[model samples]
Target: MDYDSVRTVDTAVADALIGERERQEETLAMIASENHVSEAVLEAQGSVLTNKYAEGYPGERYYAGCAYADEIEQLAIDRATELWGAEHVNVQPHSGTQANQAVYHAMLDPGDKILSLELTHGGHLSHGHPANFTGQMYTVEQYEVDPETGRIDYDGLAELAESFGPDIIVSGYSAYPRAVDWERIQAAADAVDAYHLADIAHITGLVAAGVHPSPVGIADFVTGSTHKTIRAGRGGIVMCDAEYADEIDQAVFPGGQGGPLMHNVAGKAVGFKEALTPEFEAYAQAVVDNAETLGETLVDHGLSLVSGGTDTHLVLVDLRDSHPDLSGGDAEDALTEAGIILNGNTVPGETRSPFDPSGIRAGTAGLTTRGFDGAAMEEVGDLIYRVVDNHDDEAVIEEVGERVLELCADHPLYAE
Candidate 1:
């Protein structure tokens, strides 16, 4: 990953780029929203397509000189269609947030009612957090998980829908660990004569690989980030039935953004092609297996896992019971110093601020991409528990750092 040309032009930027590559190579990436893209995807994202700007969809661009752009964009749309089995696909949203924004713009009015999960309870900002545009524009009514079980309370959601009478219901989450029952959410939306937008931003790859149930056929609209679990370059996608295809396309292009990132479209094409293979299916399953192992290991060490365990690639650990004095921020800092990376997240019933929450969320997607297995994840879990348990101990941190380095050596991220 040497940036020879970049070094010749600007040494400082090149050095930072190389430094980032080295950082990824040496450390663990357990952030549930992150993943390691394949070299092919990297190359595609860095290709000459970045020089072009296609203002519209394929064969109907508002600008000339978009032949290759059309080709890449169409390939991405086709591959996404095949993977999700959606009748229509739009691969032009710059990120998942934008993908979601497009859905709102296409189907919602400024003050329309939106019923979604609460942010602290596993919802995303785009779902309707006040800080985001979605919250400011829409009248949002939030639902919560069953505090005791740490899972979505579908019965409560139906009741909430009846009372709120929302125009649309948003499902999918950022930190939740269990598989969602799309049918249940869809039924709620149906009873209220509302639309359903399922944002699978965190589980795009799992859905693509069939490791998780897909919402393409059930939800009125489905959106996701291409990079998180999909290993595609950074981008977003929207899918729906053919009836709403034109409205979605117009909303994404003219309403939300202009000039799609063609290079990222190419990357999505390549990554989606890679995901279609049998090996990718096995990899997705392994990711879930690793998370299960990590969660069980943490439980064995007497830590509290929200929802008891995970059915996906992440486990949310509430630290209040196990390490009352240590904040999630403290654990994050200690783990990063020890070469193991993850995020401090808010649990379902968070008692602290989001900045220094009471929970840590660890994921297995990046590790599985780098060839990590259940046993490796178990060891990683132990390392995390040690660091979180002894966050202030420099000696413990150094020892854990050494073991993490050894683990990184065993599983190299990108081949030379």
Candidate 2:
């Protein structure tokens, strides 16, 4: 993985690149939205297609030299179609946020009402947070998970929808660990004649492998990140019925972005190809199994898990009950120092600031990609607890760091 060409041109940049690779190899990646793409996917993303300007969809590019770009983009669309069974798939949004942006651009007028989950209750900013364009452009209303159970209250959401009469309802989440009820959400949207956009950015691969219930057929529009559980590198996709295909295409191009990132499209093609295999199905299942084990291990150590447990590849630990004085940010810092990388996240009914919330979110998608099993994840859970329990103890952190190095060595990632 040496950046020899980069080193020849700029040694400083090369050093940083090599350092990042080392960093991934040394630590555990438990951030719910992060994952490692395969080397083949990496090669495709770093290819010469990056130089091409494919501003339009296949067979209709504004640029002249787009024959190969068309082929790659079409391949990505085809593979994504097979993976999710969508009538239309747009692989051009630069990120998941942009994917959501395209849907909004295609369907909603300015000040159109949006009903979505609250950001602190496991929802994403693109859903309706004030900082994002969706919030500014739309009339945003938010719902929440039941504070007592840490799960979405579908009945409550239905009441909110009936009262608000929103134009769209956004499902799917960033930190929520339980499976989403797309049908329930869709019903609510249907009652109000509202559109439903399910942002499956965190569980794209799980849905693709049938490990999680897919929202493709149920929701009016579905969007996801290519690099999370899917391992398709950095990009976003929008999927919907053929009826809305042209609107989505236009929205993603002239409406939001200019030229497509053809190299990332190539990466999507290759990674989606990889995901269509039996092995990938097994990996997706293992990811969930590992997460369950991790959650159980953490519970055994007296930590609190949101919703009691998880049925997906991530777990949310609310530190409020276990360590009332310790903030999630402090736990995150200690875990990082101990070579286990995860993020501090907000839980339902959060009382603290977003920067230093009450929960830490961990996922097994990256670890499972590196061939980690339930046993390995259980040990990882133990290691995490050690740091959380003794965050300020220098000796404990040093010991946990050494154990993390051992685990990293045992399950090496991106090995040459």
Candidate 3:
């Protein structure tokens, strides 16, 4: 679609929005958990559904005049089930964190024991960060990746599960590079009779495309974000066995949130329909291929990759060896100056704080969606190396930025 030509009626906001669109067209966006949705998704998100106040599920809605809203929501639910093969689907959670919270509210009590990945190691704060509601409400026992291999130690996790005997076992990550062994995780949870939840926020599209293994059939509950690789709107979804449908719905509505965002749900319906297309499957595979190629290029540039490499759309660069004196924050700023956008992430067992970690997280979803391939990724890796090597050279940074703009122009994100 010609996103550049899509005019906004409000002139004051239009200029700023156009500039932002131009910026996206001129930079390399490698943020691991971000992606560009299609114009169809955006159209659905900005539709008249936003004016409605559908405070409940289809047929049981609290507001009147929900006939059309019910149809849209039902279609969304059907598409979600067909796309992921889930027995039941909840399309109402505002975010992935809310989805997780809904599961906790439905299945666990306050002070219940929970086993999740350590945030610094790869898990998200919503899983069990000390300051988050999860940590305050539940006793969180965290597992970490093996320092030697930079991968999850399943045996170690099993041992911890046996010892901790958590009430819930959460399997997912925000930065871990390798594929998770869902069966092993399920067994670990089963050994202790704990409820198992899989948060595939980052890899949901990969799963739908069969590039990554699906956790739906094995996990008791599965939660994910619609944006990341799904290339949808900004929202979350929860899927589970049909028997738990009532509990999950109640938790999301009365327990955590109130009225649902019908507009985003409409966008999700369009996104889910797009995901079921053959083009999306190819796009998903390309994202993984681009990530692996980028990781290899980074290694060729003398950087160590966490988990040795990626099996999905993201690669975590362990900068300890390449730039012993550089912090993740410094690398972030240096790369931003060169027109490359990504986030600084903490590697496993890194002593540095989250704000200044030992690693950087980059991904292929956005770039691939922008039409970049393996060749573009190799050049991107070189740009990254140059920026890090010439951290203090403004002229060099400007030159690299121009090159990035040239690349973006060659492969426009949205046609005009």
Number of the top candidate by lDDT? Answer: 2
Name the better of 1 and 2 by lDDT: 2
**Model 1 TM-score, all chains together:** 0.99
List the global CA lDDT of all models.
0.94, 0.95, 0.91
Model 2: per-residue Cα lDDT over 1-416, one tens digit each:
89999999999999999999999999999998899999999999999998899888899988798989998898999999999999999999999999999999999999999999999999999999999998889999999999889899999999999999999999999989999999999999999999999999999999999999999989999999999999996899999999999999999999999998999999999999999999999999999999999999999999999999999999999999999999999999999999999999999889899999999999999999999988888999999999999999999999999999999999999876
Clashing pairs in 1: none
Better of 1 and 3 by lDDT: 1
Instruction: Give TM-scores for every candidate, taking all chains together and pairing residue i with residue i.
Output: 0.99, 0.99, 0.97
Model 1 per-residue lDDT tens digits across residues 1-416: 89999999999999999999999989999999999999999999999998998898899989999988988888898899999999999999999999999999999999999999999898999999999999999999999999999999999999999999999999999999999999999999999999999999999999999989999999999999999898887899999999999999999989999999999999999999999899999999999999999999999999999999999989999999989888888899999999999999999889999999999999999999999988888899899989888899999999999998889999998887
In model 3, what lDDT does residue 359 have?
A: 89
Query: Best to worst by lDDT, what's the order?
Result: 2, 1, 3
Q: Per-prediction RMSD in angstroms?
A: 0.7, 0.7, 2.0
TM-score of 3: 0.97
Alpha carbon deviation, residue 321, candidate 1 (Å): 0.8
Model 3 regions lying over 4 Å from their true place: 1-12
lDDT (Cα, 0-100) at 28 in candidate 3? 89
Q: Which ten residues in a row have the lowest lDDT in candidate 3?
A: 1-10
